[model samples]
Target: MKLIYVFFFFCIINQTYGQQKELELIHNCQGRLSGFATVKVIDKRDSSGKQMIGIVQKGALNKPVKVVFNGELTDSLAAFFIDQSANSNPLPLVLILNELFISEAIDNMTEIGRFRLSLRLFIGKQSDQYSEIVAIDSLYTVKGLDVTKKLLRSISEQFCKISQLAAEKQPILDTDAEKYTFKQLHYLDSLEKMKLPMYQTDHPSVGLYKNYKEFKQNTPGVTAELSIEERKNGFRVYIWDEKRKNKTKLPSTGLYAVSDGTTLLRATPLGFFKILKKGGDFYYWRPQVNKSHHSLVPAAYMYGALGGLVYGLIEAASAGNNKWLLQKINYRKGSAAPVSWTTAKEN
Candidate 1:
């Protein structure tokens, strides 16, 4: 009875003192970068010299370009930048802003109204998020650059600040199933329906295996078959091992990513692929490079002529043609490696 009382007392003391509980680890997230995607609206001058608005629902920039926001309100604007961030490597976050708007504030600069140059930023990363309306720079004391230049500078500066925050905070990310959210719901709906334009490959269908035995009959190591099934309207990936007699199915989205070492294009190039080397996030594969003749400029004009030629060829041989095999994607950059096919076939 005495021992029981002593144990109960100890338990009560522990609870009261807030001791013995395991400490929760707070991961510091770092890295901040900002890229600009053009907004889908058009601005034009009317016959009367007044500004007009046009809408291009399916328009976008060739690629996401880096943007910098300058002036007094840079930090406030950048607070909304979003990008690909992982907890393990948090110092270099690059948030690609899909839509940027710089409004005309001349209409309300009176005593009762302050027409400060305000801005709005929107991003699409499987979710939608935007920054609140903040008055960064007052038009009354504007500087050398115009509204467009100021907006870009401010946006970029905001990103640098976020990078610093990531370096200091190191916020950890949850798994795909964890459903971590940083985006606002209003833009999320628009982002979900947005899809980039892509190219169709010559070889659309690439497989026909009913089961593991059917696909694993004669492959060497880990055999993966990627195919586009037109009838089912889905892309499929199958993986199997010869010795273990086991198979695993990886998720697929009915399309293959092709690249040009500078961009990621989509196409189903029907050819055998190998598991060359695996990296932390990307499966490196040989991309096809086409050395097409752009107007023959002097060697000196194109990277010092002979030196430039050698450099281009070498680049094509290395990262230029290397493509990333991702879990999912719609529109990829042109920075893909060259395209090529090998003879490592599957059963």
Candidate 2:
């Protein structure tokens, strides 16, 4: 009985000390970052160029430090920004806001346990924005004036790290289109060789069609056998009329192919292409690089030149005229040449 009593006493002391530590962390952060605690809306623009209104708890000088909205409203807005499925329950915007504080506190080396405990005390019981702020104010007892400078210094350091990481990952050029064209050609070739029936809604088909009805009616087997052959510039796609026993040229679309040394990006003709080396998988389109605009110009120009030359050679080679190929080539200009298919097949 005496041992049990001592254990209970120690447990209570530890709990009390933990509560005190949590309070200290909250006090430190709230005091320092109170000035920077303005509410910000993510992706607030609408089609009419109006800023979507949010529920605001006004601070001094017409600023807002706390914002409240129906949980459904916050979820809907969050879904729009993150492309996540809409949430049915109300989510506390303060929880999201407090993450910014938590991130700052962590950078300052405020013990992780104490920082998390403070956030729990501040917002855990509340499910909406106004209630959360009120809860935090009541639990932490933070006076607006008692400022903590160290927390703000930590936040500035964290922001700098984020900026540096973004800069390091920036691309050198826009090569997505060229890369995408190659993949599409590869996909078309694979489908033909495997004798896989192209589905009506397949990415390549939908990309090539201008109208929905035309896209719907043109079955794969009925139309030409589409195949792609690779060359130095880009790729040459052949549309063969099986009924006519002949091949014809399809309109060529310009593509952009960008590489980060590890990943290849292609955007053009049909859409975006993304090829990651890890899975050995290929895609047709990818998002364009937007952050490092000025640094990419020279590399983009070089890729464009290389892509054009490759595309031209592939087009000529696919046209299947040895005489035409010879006429175009300076070395073979004076030499009589046999048919392209005979030479190509022999080699």
Top of the candidates by TM-score: 2
What are the per-residue Cα lDDT tens digits for candidate 1 across 80-144? 33333443331222233222322212212111111122222222233322222111222222232
lDDT of 1 at 242: 49
In model 1, the number of clashes is 51
Per-residue lDDT of 103 in model 2: 11
TM-score for candidate 2, residues paired by index: 0.20
> How close is each model in CA RMSD to the real structure?
26.6, 28.0
The lDDT leader among the candidates is 1
Off by over 4 Å in 1: 1-283, 288-347
TM-score of each: 0.20, 0.20
- Candidate 1: minimum summed lDDT over ten consecutive residues — where? 54-63
- Residue 338, candidate 2: alpha-carbon lDDT: 12
lDDT of 2 by residue, 1-347 (tens): 44553454344334432121111111122212111122222221121111111111111111112112223432332221221234311222222211222111111212111111111111111222122122111111111221233332333343333223322332213433122222232233233324322121233331233322232232222233554554544445545675848866554444223222222233345432342221111223112111111212332354454433433443344343211110000010111111111112210
Segments of candidate 2 deviating more than 4 angstroms: 1-222, 253-282, 285-347
- Looking at model 1, residue 60 earns an lDDT score of 12
